[model samples]
Target: MPAYEIDGYDNLIAGMVQPIVTQSIIINQATDAKFERGTVLARTGFTEEGMWVCTIVNSEATPAEEKVPVGVLADEEVDATTAQQRATAYVSGEFNRDALIFGGTDTIATHEAALNAAKIYTKRVVK
Candidate 1:
């Protein structure tokens, strides 16, 4: 067997890192309103807490927001020196554990257990 690197990356340890993708939207803050980073969001039907990141809205969500989990506000404020962040508007990309209903747990559960845990994920991660 042989170990190797590709594209200047240490291939042997590639699995150690998982880069989750995210996006941001202007929540249209008022005089005192502001949103913070790592805020979970959805298209429609928000609750008092959880399942939502921002407290403000630009307008009533059109057709239940972007039709899927629009990711979170990767950048809560402007960056004077550089871009706050970068991401795609719409696409299935990796997200931090906070994006998931159940925070990232590494337990190797059985099929049924994993399915049970992933149920809410399936419903919220997207439409």
Candidate 2:
């Protein structure tokens, strides 16, 4: 996995000190691996932001038994031209969108890098 570094900022009012801290780790993916509702996807080096917005995209048919309790999934099966296409899609459910934030002090370049990393780290489906 490819890795990168990001500089995070924190401010101290008492000391009047603004410190830039570096966070190093492997890239994060925008797309997540396909899993059933009950599946427990491991949370590894994902940062607080990552964990906040982290979601599993279902790329396959959901079993009736695996349905989420919150009435998220509308259908058991998603339509795809081929199995390959289907595997790239996310599951039908109410994903956690609370992770999104607006108007932060972070630089636009920094945010762009993070977004790009997500694309690179996306999970792949096997035929």
TM-score of each candidate? 0.29, 0.17
What is the C-alpha lDDT profile of model 1 across 15-80, one tens digit per residue? 223333333333323343333443333334333443332322222335534223444334433222
Clashing pairs in 2: 30-118, 57-90, 57-91, 58-90, 58-91
What TM-score does model 2 achieve against the real structure?
Answer: 0.17
- Model 2: worst 10 consecutive residues (lDDT sum): 66-75
Q: For model 2, what is the C-alpha lDDT against the true structure?
A: 0.23
lDDT of 2 by residue, 30-124 (tens): 33332322221111324554421122221231442211111111112222222211111122221222221212232223233332233211111
What is the total number of backbone clashes in candidate 2?
A: 5
